[model samples]
Target: MRIADHATWDRGFPVKYLLVQEDEDGVEQLWGRCTGVEGFFVDPVPPPREILTLRGCRPDGLLSEVLAEPDVSLRCLGDVCVEVCDDEKPVQWWTLADAVVVAHQPHQADPERYDIVLGAGVRSEESFFELPATSHFELFAGTRVAAASAGRCSGVDGLFKARVDLAPVPMELIGCEPAEPLLAALRRPRRSERDWAYLLVLDRHGAVMASRSVGLAITGTRPSVLGGILVDITLTDGGNDRPSLAARPIWAEWYQGSPTEPNLWAPYDS
Candidate 1:
């Protein structure tokens, strides 16, 4: 995403949509994890206006900043936490080695995980507004961070990132011997023509509930939509095989005195 005007500081200008130049692309078939099913997914349309920060910039070559996906909110990254699941365990805690601040995904065929490529998990530090001045963690390439279903909000169908760093795992917080099959799934990868992919880091017992945006809209004069749809999608952890499931049409729209942010989108495909 590009800023409307980089010349000024806070409240200077609104942020534009992604894919302005020939190189900007959300479907990273050329290039491009999850705590739960909520950690995966994206919106194909112009994403909701969001604010992002460079985690650990590379001094020479490697670029750590990546586009996770717009389905995952940038501001919400402050409350995310990583965790692992097993047959004998509820949810085991894990540290976020890498952080995925914001991004957007657009995969419809997938009923489970489809937004991993968009990069919308947690900030891996704290609230988006409360990040430390000094940068740490990996700065060259993307790092793997395992999180849990708890990361996504159930009511809003959005995610909640942790504002503080990951806490230590209890000595007894481990599960029975590792389930190789489950472990393999957690670290699995996806392939798609659109490239809006995500890994199914779930056991065979749950269903993944996801919601993808199908339209593009912008409103209001504020640099950003003043509290548009907080996309409160607390992605619950379940699989397609779950005995029961529910879904509803969630809409997001905004309007104000003047359109502050300039929105853009590449007419790539239908």
Candidate 2:
């Protein structure tokens, strides 16, 4: 299983790697031992790096840019990605088979900078990141892989098939923007304005904001789908407990409004 940990600048440099093994018995064990590791800003996300967007990782929806060199296998991603979830199990877990390896180039050359664009095409709607199955998968670079040749991808264009057993990446509701581009691609409905609710789904991390409000009859993010017209948040004060926000928020009172996009709405059969 691949384990993913955020590289935080404020935390320190040279991010560490931890490996956990879960046998058939369901027993979990921890493994920690790595060397010559380092990281920096991934761009777009935050400093510590929450969501990584490697440009041109997977240029084509279904193809990976074969490395121009040899001995460069796809296992380069340390072979696994542990998403770093909390005590609670992650929302999703799955394996990726035969993915593409867009391209590779040393960062600093001398010391060898390995961070490169890692992309995967979406094959199933049941994919993460409300983006879609056809969208590319984003990832951060890790450990070195030892394959056979480190040459160009002309001879073996589609031969460098890869498998990524991705573990869930830890994610929290950090920010939410009232508008988004993906939000513009949802299915809206026409109603009395009293029967709808606003919903937010977090399958994979968002490319832009923490959350985007998309008006639609079917509300879903990636793995999890939620639908409604409103989301209610309440804060309770002193009790036997310290000040904290409620674990669950209440949805809005019954709402009945047609899904509107500025001045347009999908036509409904009356």
Model 2 lDDT on a 0 to 1 scale: 0.25
The deviation in Å at residue 240 for candidate 1 is 43
The TM-score that candidate 2 achieves is: 0.17
Error of 2 at 144 (Å): 22
Q: What is the C-alpha RMSD of each candidate to the true structure, in Å?
A: 26.2, 23.9
Per residue, candidate 2 scores C-alpha lDDT tens digits across 91-138 of 322222233344455544332333344343322213452322222233
Clashes of 2: 35
**lDDT per residue as tens, model 1, 1-270:** 222222112332221111111123543211101111221222212123323333222222112112333334442332223322233432333233233444434334443322332233333222233222331222222233532232221111222333433322111101111123322322453332332222222222222222221110111111112233111112122112221211111101121222245542122221
Let me know the TM-score candidate 1 reaches against the reference structure. Answer: 0.17
Which stretches in model 1 have alpha-carbon errors above 4 Å? 1-73, 97-100, 106-113, 117-270
